[model samples]
Target: MHESPITGNGDVVKARQAVRVLAQEARLSLVDQTKLVTAASELARNTLSYGGGGTMRASIVTRGTSTGVKVVFSDQGPGIPDLDLALTDGWSSGRGMGLGLSGARRLADEFTLDSAPGKGTTVSVLKWAR
Candidate 1:
């Protein structure tokens, strides 16, 4: 796994680039690469703006004959109090339209989220090669 710090908007861009590289290395199609990159951008921005910055871990994952990329974003900031509400479309705790999490989930083949009021949050998403 490779970890990159997400301290600001610039770091979010870096995260997107990093994911793009990994997706390319995994032999993902251009469309799949774009999807993963876009999802990474959104999640990284959320990590910085909402979670007060965090770390993004990218890794290559293989399952049988399938290979994919997995990214996990973690932060120590104030966690989502109501995950259900937070996951709702158009719900925003800050200035965004609240589409980051839901949108990322929609782009990835698999998505998982873990958060607590004071314990912080971690979101993991995966995109498989076609």
Candidate 2:
């Protein structure tokens, strides 16, 4: 497993790079790597811009005959009050394009989101190698 912090823009880039490296190590196709990296970048940015600061954990996993990379972004900032709205494609609490969560979900093979009004938020995504 690879773990890193998401405190600034540089950390977001690092997180994206780490996801790319893990995706490559897992033998994912170029397209799959790009998808995962893009998702990771958005989530990492959210962790910094919205979550105030957080951490990213990424790892390569194997199941049966399939291999994939999983990444988790966690933050202890003001959580989403409405998950449905947050997941909407054109909804943005800030000045973003409002496509981060929804776009990441569409790009990832598996997506999980957890957040609350006062608690923190955590987003996890998995992309399998073809």
Candidate 3:
């Protein structure tokens, strides 16, 4: 597993690049790699902009003969109060168009989100190799 702090734009780019490398190492297809990278970028940005900086953990996962990448973004900032509204399309709590969370969810094979009013947020996404 590889971990990086998401405190700035540069860190976000590094996180995206790290995930790209992991995706390549996992032998993910070109399409899958792009999808994972895009999702990671969006999530990383959210971590910095909304979460007030956090950490990104990327790991290679396996299940029998299948291989995949799992990335978790965690933060200790103010958490999401309305998960349903946050997941909804075209909603924005800040300056964003509000598609970051929802779009990331659509790109990954599996997605999980945990958050509360004050406990912060944790989002995990996994994309399996084809």
lDDT, model 1: 0.92
Model 3 lDDT at residue 37: 94
Give model 1's TM-score versus the native structure: 0.97
TM-score of 2: 0.98
> Against the hidden true structure, what lDDT does model 2 obtain?
0.94
Which clashing pairs does model 3 show?
none
Write down the TM-score of every candidate: 0.97, 0.98, 0.98
Q: 2 or 3: which has the higher lDDT?
A: 3
Q: What's the ranking of the predictions by lDDT, best on top?
A: 3, 2, 1
**Tens digits of lDDT, candidate 3, 1-130:** 9999999889988998999999999999999999999999989999998899999999999999999999999999899999999999998787678988999999999999999988999999999999
Give each model's whole-structure lDDT.
0.92, 0.94, 0.95
Q: Write the per-residue lDDT of candidate 2 for residues 1-130, one digit (tens) a residue.
A: 9999999878988898889889999999999999999999989988888999999999998889999999999999999999999999999887579999999999999999999987999999999999
Model 3 clash tally, residue pairs: 0
Which is the better candidate, 1 or 3, if ranked by lDDT? Answer: 3
